[model samples]
Target: ASYSVRRVVKKSKRRYGRKLESQFQHGGSRSLWQGLRTITDYRTPSSRMVNADASLADELNARFKAADNHANGASGTNSVHAERAGEVNTFTTSEHDVRRAFKRVNTR
Candidate 1:
């Protein structure tokens, strides 16, 4: 779940970064403040001026909780069968494993 959340966030940031880069490259704003304002003042369809981070966090939390409930509601026998069906369907990595992998890569 954490991995899924992190992957979503990373993709979102990359997409937003590309958007900002395109805006700066083509928008032809004369000043840094103008460019910043263009980026900051832009509104999406569901844009809100306040508590955006909190709202996004709440939404993601709800989504994750729903997914957890759905997964947990699976019958034990069905879940066992599902687990045996494929290794790719399982989340095999732990936080410790990620940390150790990072450490090894950094040391090298």
Candidate 2:
């Protein structure tokens, strides 16, 4: 059941991502700005609206930073060290494993 739900979610995400990409390609900056505005205009759980005068980019950045700081504090790790560790880990990809995965996809 969980697998089926995951598959539906993945499909929806891919479809939406493609639609956004197409919109950005054809509509350019206007489409991107509209999407951001729509997302940020959503009402909070308390039914309060986001301040119209506030810069959405700054607001989002501050919120994300706070969330990141909280997560780091909970995990007992400094953000700088965590970020550096992530950068180091990205280089450890296995080409053989990746190729095998793609082969399985082709078989499907």
- Candidate 1 structure quality by residue, lDDT tens digits, 29-103: 455446566767854477465656787888998777667657878533346556668765656899999998888
lDDT of candidates 1 onward, in order? 0.71, 0.75
Please provide the root mean square deviation of candidate 1 (C-alpha atoms, Å).
19.5
* Stretches of model 1 off by over 4 angstroms after superposition: 28-108
Worst lDDT run of 10 residues, candidate 2, spans 42-51
Residues 1-108 of candidate 2 have per-residue lDDT tens digits of 999999999999898778778888886778776776786685436745655555877899777877887876754545686668756454566999898888889542
- Top candidate on lDDT is 2
Report the Cα lDDT for candidate 1: 0.71
Model 2 steric clash pairs: none
